[model samples]
Target: MASSADDVFTAICGGTFVYPAVMHEQYQDIRVTNRDGVTLGSIREITYGHAISRMVSRATEEITRIDHTSRTIESRFKPNALSTFNEFIGSDLLRDPSEVVGQNL
Candidate 1:
């Protein structure tokens, strides 16, 4: 059975044939070749640990860009929402709500 890494390598290499990998070395060299055995490119193995970190970093960057774009689009419709929120917090609404019953008792 081909491992997940092998699948990923095969996909990245544009549907090329992935040669039988040698497992002795610290890294797995995925020889990318066409159907007729023409070498296309070299695929290097990434450890599972490093792959997780790289995936997380990439996801975080994409999420940040999405969040920023959405916030900008929303702000265009409600430009004063943020400032109003800040003003409300800065005002005495937090200190005295006028509905509390007994405070000095």
Candidate 2:
């Protein structure tokens, strides 16, 4: 069995969210936190031109889902922008379980 921490990581591996502010364009971001709300680190689709392209390409594939297609912000808004690039990707990542097996004993 996987520990709670493991579960959390697996859940956020390739998750999706709707950003209404960004024209409702689907996006993905990695946010790691503990029970105390201490964030470990986070990586959003936003990528930089100076950044590694190989890493960005691989990450792009991992974050977006194949089912519900979403426009990658990088491809749409700033395709030629001399800045970081953002990809669209999402999956079942870091979501609360549908049901709890048990309660406080």
Candidate 3:
């Protein structure tokens, strides 16, 4: 599952063709050090948002945009997701870029 702030990349109704390689060398430090848990992306999206008008209404907890050519990514996290994130990661370290501050989570 390739997940981003706004999208969870899945094909054929979310079935995976291959493992995500959680044990890859480059990701070793992340998995090895943060044994307890992990949260991805910048949380600056936690408090900001934009409204889009549509004929069919829907609800969302987050929003994200990526510009490959410009090499930029943006995300917005709503109250529920933010609160949940803070609860999971703790409220004390609710900074812009959410990160692993300690070893073994």
Best by lDDT: 2
Where does candidate 3 have its weakest 10-residue lDDT segment? 23-32
Q: TM-score of every model?
A: 0.15, 0.17, 0.21
lDDT of 3 by residue, 1-105 (tens): 112222322311232222121111111111111211122332221121212211111112222454446644443423333222221232233333223222123
Error at 52, model 2, angstroms? 29
- Per-residue alpha-carbon lDDT of candidate 1 for residues 1-105, written as tens digits (9 for 90 to 100): 112334543443244222222122212212222221112222232221111121100000000111223322111111122221111111123433122221111
Runs in model 3 deviating more than 4 A are 1-63, 81-105
lDDT of 3: 0.24
Clashing pairs in 1: none
Q: What lDDT score belongs to each candidate, Candidate 1 first? A: 0.21, 0.25, 0.24
Provide C-alpha RMSD values for all models, in order.
Answer: 25.0, 16.7, 16.0
